[model samples]
Target: MLKYMLMIVFSTFLLCGCSYSEEKISTFEGQIDYVSGKQIKVDCSNTVAANSEESGDQVGVGYICFAAINGQTKLEDNNGNSLSINDFTIEDKIKIFLESPKNIGKSLESRKFTASKVILIKASPAPK
Candidate 1:
């Protein structure tokens, strides 16, 4: 009986520890240095938002709505971190490391990427 009780206690501790670590996943920050048909590049800051967008046509689990500048396109989150690969907006605020985009052909409205993280940086308003 004592052995079984000890096993249960250890298992519980392990499960709890795993959850705590998952919540502490590392986050990066950077400016949107570059963007192209296939990938994008963000300069790094510190804090970042994972999921935030204006709602899209095809919505589902792990799918966050985002609006690309031109072509009025939406992005799907097949990648690990949906927040990491959000659409880029010219006036968007972001903080992330440099990386390439996975899928290509995504429209960039006026050639500007959608904002990745809402928390990373505060996008300035467009000129009047």
Candidate 2:
């Protein structure tokens, strides 16, 4: 009986420990730093839609992370058009989303997980 209780307690703790960051995850904006095969490294920066009425906003995030694209990953443009991983280019601005993204230890740490969706917001050239 004691063993069962301990197991239940441990399981609860593990489940509760995994939480998404509303601020960071909701506004997961970054630039493509590197890409290799199915994964892309993003340099996290800035807050987006902080005061909007959008839903599904999670909290906390990292400064850098790796998001992988697979069969289930959704790639799209701002117009809601479909896209493929090949369409992505380095230095492109993007906002990534994860169904259940995991973080490294604590807030603003780092991430290395698969992406659920990726939205492209094409990069523009610098002003002359």
Candidate 3:
């Protein structure tokens, strides 16, 4: 009887321990369309697919997303080097880890996608 009770307690503890992990953040990848201060607009048209499209090519509409960077957000470059927003430029490819959208405004142009982290995958080419 004591052995069975111990097994039940151990199983409970294992289940509880496995459930206490960091919340998962959603990720989006695209090229930078615009950047101002801590805010960035990503042109995800080539990357994101609309829900209506089952073939993944029926829709021709562009999909752009905006993300806001705060002090807590982590920024890193392709080489795993630490970076800042200043290091980013238009046309740069980035992967954004976003916090769930809260009160996303009606207008897509005005909607804000809060980012928890931003990783730079490729830098834009320098103009000759």
Candidate 4:
């Protein structure tokens, strides 16, 4: 029994260690459909799923971006180009890098620059 437990523990540790890769970068490609005040609505590619969403009784994933802090933030692109969050117009295509919520109480509160980093990949006029 003891040997079996030790093997399970060792396997867990090995699985975790192997999951870490230096070259791995978290990125999401999507289109911003709406922005009101600090609230944002986006629709990602059908192939990819949203990490977070408002509410749903569905299987697929979708996300929304809202200001957690009543302050300004800097938006950047995948190439490291930066833009003022205030200047972000609606219906822009973007690549966002988000940090998963660290605490339950801080889920929505984690949307700020202090809590999360947002990178705007590409911005284009809404398709007419």
Candidate 5:
């Protein structure tokens, strides 16, 4: 009787341990630095608060991070047009929603983020 009880308890614990939970998502704004097959490097140097009164200077020394894109990832432009990874170009500003890295408190370059969505922010017209 004791052997059967131990087995039942062990099975219950094993099943509980195998359950999965979704990872939390985080967002960051930056410019596209590089793009490859299914990955991109972002230069998050110019991120700033929308309502701040600052002179548009970068908050601090920004670090570049790479994000992986998957089929489930959503991509869109400011005009609500759907886009693909191939539409991105270097120097294009974007806002990215991604899974926060496990070691977030560590140095900037040590973290890894996986992108879930990307929104393109239109660039301003250049002076002639």
Candidate 6:
């Protein structure tokens, strides 16, 4: 009984030590597509999907990343001026700094990650 319990605990620790995350901050520049209370959807790509038909743009290979904002996420302008989340709007160009998982035989861009910093590159022009 005790032997089995210790073995399980050790296995759990070992698994956690070899986590899939890369422990590195990765960044990508993109335009904001959707924004909610604490999460934002960013359009980060514009290429065509590999499996899409070559006739036209059947399936877009565009990558949209959903970033979850928190107190730690620093929202700033291009000049490093602090800003509020409300300042963000659709189509705004921004660069997001986030922690990415290790590229384990897959594209990490397809997964959502917590945004560490959001820097507004360019705000969409005011609507008429």
**RMSD for each of the candidates:** 14.6, 9.4, 9.9, 7.6, 11.2, 10.7
Predicted structure 5: lDDT: 0.68
Which sections of candidate 6 miss by over 4 Å? Answer: 1-25, 46-60, 100-109
For model 4, what is the alpha-carbon lDDT of residue 49? 24
The TM-scores of all predictions, comma-separated, are 0.31, 0.57, 0.65, 0.43, 0.58, 0.63
lDDT of 4 by residue, 39-65 (tens): 445554231223323224442444344
Deviation from native of the Cα of residue 49 in model 3, angstroms: 1.6
Report the C-alpha lDDT of model 1 over 45-101, residue by residue, as the tens digit.
121122212234432222212223223222322232333334554545454321223
Q: Itemize residue pairs with steric clashes in candidate 2.
A: 21-58, 21-59, 21-60, 22-58, 22-59, 23-59
**lDDT agreement with native, every candidate:** 0.37, 0.67, 0.72, 0.48, 0.68, 0.73
**Would you list the rank order by TM-score, best first?**
3, 6, 5, 2, 4, 1
Q: Pick the candidate with the highest lDDT.
A: 6
Q: Model 3: how far is 124 from its true place, Å?
A: 1.0
Q: Which portions of model 5 show Cα errors greater than 4 Å?
A: 1-25, 46-59, 100-110, 123-128
List model 3 lDDT by residue over 59-120, tens digit each. 42466778988888888987778888899999999998877634322247434678888899
Worst 10 residues of 2 by lDDT: 45-54
Task: Compare the candidates by TM-score and give the number of the best one.
Answer: 3
Tens-digit per-residue lDDT, 30-122, candidate 6: 799998869889875442133222334534445676788998899999999999999999999999887553221125455477888999999
Question: Candidate 5, which ten residues in sequence have the lowest lDDT sum?
Answer: 46-55
The per-candidate count of clashes, in order, stands at 23, 6, 0, 0, 0, 0
Full ranking by lDDT? 6, 3, 5, 2, 4, 1
Which 10 residues in a row give candidate 1 its minimum summed lDDT? 45-54
